[model samples]
Target: MHLSNQGLLVILVVGVVAGWLAGRVMAGGGFGLIGDLLVGLVGAFIGDWLMPQLGIHLGVGIVALIINAFIGAVVLLLILRLIGGGFGGRRRWI
Candidate 1:
């Protein structure tokens, strides 16, 4: 969706926080600012795509957005872990 400047800022901040949290949960620490930001941004895309297929509708609002992004980030991390591959790897899954 198209976000205004303020909305984008909010997403950035939320995504950073959510990514950091996911990193901590998965890797035992934060992935640094840039790493976290990337994860969060990608997570937003994942959530936007996956949530609908899963029949999970969080609706709108800042809280829903944050929740969606955070959940997606965590799922991405988990998938990465299970696949035992880094982002540079051509095959992320076995």
Candidate 2:
């Protein structure tokens, strides 16, 4: 479904916040506003693609989207860490 401009804007804002929160919770890092938003938007697509491949389906809704955002943020943080871009400190998760 195509989103109106306002809808898209709302989604972007939500995605940014969700992404930042997810990153904080999962990686203990601050990605700033723009970075969070970009990560969220990209994460949405990646989550949608990966979930099904992993035999998990959340259907579609706000909740599903939020789950997607969280997954995406986690994935992005992992990638960032792998590339030596994560916050410098002890690794929290192994």
Q: Which pairs of residues clash in candidate 2, taking residues 3 or more apart in a chain or in different chains?
A: none
lDDT by residue (tens digit), candidate 1, 22-54: 787775466789989988888888988999999
lDDT of 1 at 7: 77
Candidate 1 residue pairs that clash: none
- Candidate 2, residue 3: Cα displacement in angstroms equals 3.9
Tens-digit per-residue lDDT, 65-87, candidate 2: 88877797678778877798567
Query: Which candidate number maximizes lDDT?
Result: 1
Worst 10 residues of 1 by lDDT: 85-94
Q: Which candidate is the best by TM-score?
A: 1
Query: What's the lDDT for all of these models?
Result: 0.82, 0.77
Q: For each candidate, give its TM-score against the true structure.
A: 0.77, 0.76
